[model samples]
Target: MRPGIIDRYILRYFLGTYFLVLILILLIAIVFDISEKIEDFITRGATPREIIFDYYLNFIVYYGNMFTSMIVFISTIFFTSMLTNRTEIVAILTGGMSFRRLMVPYFIGTATIALLSMALAHYIIPISNVRRLHFENLYINQNTGERYSDIHRQIKPGHLIYLENYNPDRKSGYRFTYEVFDGQKLLSKLSSDFIRYDTLTGTWRLDNYTIRVIGTDGDKLVIGRQKDTLLEFKPDELSPSLYSVTMMNTPRLLEFIRAERIRGSEKVNMYLIELHQRTAWPFATVILVLIAVSISSQKRRGGMGFNIALGLALCVTYIFFQRVSVVFSTNGNLSPLAALWLPNLLFAIIGAFLYRIAPK
Candidate 1:
């Protein structure tokens, strides 16, 4: 079916205003960001190419996704309020246009933007963040120091793993400890403080080490440690950011959540929150659009000016809730999914109520 003339007009107006407002807000943000980073770039002797291409390009995208809902709400308010104030909306309704039909174009526009934002956030923006964050750390923070060694994090149930000193240049950690436990009782402890791998033997050489084994009957045995042994652990897994929560994608995030739960780790809340929040964020586009349309569509004495103020306040409230919910998630008091999406669920209900009272 062909779209009516009103559909085209509404689509053009909605999308045009959306992009226009997005650009205006992003440009202002970019200007401010550049102003702040300019001194750092100058002091670090960074090239203009590095400053613009390496940093600001990704910086803009990160901020754009972060502020997407605000842009949507503000743009919708500006466009819808303009139509109401100019009497165009009334003219269209009088000319046999139902508000429902008029909303089709706006919804289409928002759906497109929502999908785009989702793809950029999930797939594209993260890759950019890797580079942008690297640039900031390397240049801004002057993090040219040598990478730390002997880094180990607990990976199993009631087990402690340690690395003596890892050499990132060689992708290896020397002198490792892998301990296993049953409840509060230690079942076995493997201590190798001078462990080194022999490329020729494909085995680890542990110098002056002892393996202590505990019996279920409360007995202990000292298993003599050999100068050389073989284990299946790879040093690269212990590298910085390899297992970092931020570096993990959605699947890995789920895997971490599962494994951490089995291990009884308390630090998995942040990862769980990130996983649920990524999925929840896309739906917010629709929620905010509904709220913005309902809030701004009614004609008022002050028109767009007052509507814009209200929209800004509502946007801030929504964002504030989003951040606050993360605190609950991090503290593990609230379910991660609920913590991330509670604001959207509540606002969606409010949006529905407001839409019902919006002008027909």
Candidate 2:
């Protein structure tokens, strides 16, 4: 259906107010952030150009996209509250517009924001995060280490490798062991005192290695001083930084997850949660808009602040659920898909209930 006069008017109000609120909130956020980190910026010799163009530019885009659902809900409640205060909602109702009809422009507006948000979160933001996080690591978090200890990886079907105290910068590890199994039967085992990547030959070199082969009658053993061979994984893959997950685009993230699964990484759930949340959170904007309209369309003696407070509180609850669900996924028995979308499912039910009882 073609959008008529009322739809156009509401679309303009909603989208305009959305950007306006985003700008206002982001300005205040940047101010507070600068106040908090100015000493680091100065001491670390961050040029003004770098701080403004490199850090804060990407910062605004990254964080602004991060809280998009909240921004969208706030925009919806604020605009709808203004209409309620002015009795425009009542007039529209009295003049023959149904509540469902009135929501057309709102949902359309939310779709616009949600699509934009998902595009950024999945593709654009990750690219910018590289620079933004790089700046942060150099200036703000200089002392942090990226060391990983006690690594295990499945190089292929029935083939597993283990290492102790793997270091990324050195591309090496200590006390390495490789085992090949056939079903429950042990096939062969290789042990090494140390393993390091040989950049020139593009192979992993093992020092003082011993290989044990299980035979039908007994066992065979082979010892070597220095040997270079393929190990099917890079050192960094075993110790992927937490920020690395957030900094990957959708396709790379999917590939990374598949690779981690093959490697039998324990943090597979964490990567899955990040991937699922990218899609689920953006789609949640539609449900949030419906809820905002339902609660904020009524005229209240307490005015707009009340609706805004209620909406923010609800958004906070939504975020809390997301956080808790993530913990469950990473540390408990919850699945990634359920963890990422359970809040949306719960709130969608609440929205339907609220819509049923909303002023008609």
Candidate 3:
């Protein structure tokens, strides 16, 4: 349906204010980030152009999506409070437009933002994170060492690999073992003192290795000084940092989660939380818009300040609850779906309650 004049007016103001607020918040974040990292950039001899285009460009996208819900709430509160002050909302309501009907344009505006946010979270952000994270690791973290220890994984069905220590820089491992199993029965085992990945040959070179084959009759053992073998796993897959999940887009993330589960990784819960959060975080935009309109639509004695303060308070509470729930999911036995979504669900109910009693 073609939008009427009132709907168009409200949508135009809402979108204009939303983009303005988003830009302002991102600018403030970039300023603070530069302040904190200026010394590192200077010490690393990072040029201004590189800093602007390479670092802050990706930085803005990351934090912009990160804080979209807060921006939505603030924008909605600011614009709706202005409408209340000007008595535009009162005029519309007096003209037989119900408060529920007034929400149509707001919902449309928020849905647009929410869809954009979801797309960014699931696809664009992760691709940008590759460069952002690489830049930070080289210039900011500056800690280059072994990222994984005592690693174990099932690279494929019935094939297990273990490493006592892995050095990502050298692409080598010490005390490596590979095992093959058949329905809870050991088929064969390969142990090596040291294993180095031969990038030229795309294979693994095992030094001072021993292999044992198990059969119905007995175990057959073989020893060798050096050997080269093809393996299903790669060095990169074996040594991922805790934050590696953030670098994967949705499809890669799903594949990683499946592999991690097969490898019996305890950190799979964190990945699951991240997966659920991509969608859940964006959906909060709608909830926050409803809450903001409910709280800010009626002009009070304290005027816009009162409504803005209340909205900020609620936003803070929402963030606090979200963090607490994530901690529960990560540390406790809480389900990731429940932990990531509980805040949105609770606030949605609050929005409904406020909507019920909001001034028409």
| Local distance difference test values of all predictions, in order | 0.75, 0.91, 0.91
Candidate that beats the other on TM-score, 1 or 3, i.e. the better one: 3
Q: Comparing 1 and 2 by TM-score, which wins?
A: 2
Q: Which lDDT tens digits does candidate 1 get at residues 25-136? A: 8899888977877888888888888888888888888788867767887899999999889888888877777777778888888898888887776667667877787788
Q: How close is candidate 1 to the true structure, as a TM-score?
A: 0.80
User: Candidate 3 has what TM-score?
Assistant: 0.92
Ranking by lDDT: 3, 2, 1
lDDT score of residue 76 within candidate 1: 91
Q: What residue pairs are clashing in model 3?
A: none
| RMSD vs true structure, all candidates | 4.9, 2.4, 2.3
Candidate 3 backbone overlaps, count: 0
> TM-scores for all candidates?
0.80, 0.92, 0.92
Q: Candidate 1: misplaced stretches above 4 Å?
A: 1-3, 142-177, 182-185, 191-210, 215-244, 259-264
Error of 1 at 123 (Å): 1.5
Per-residue lDDT of 17-120 in model 3, one digit per residue for the tens? 99999999888888898899999999988878778777889999999999999999999999999999999999999888888889999999999999999999
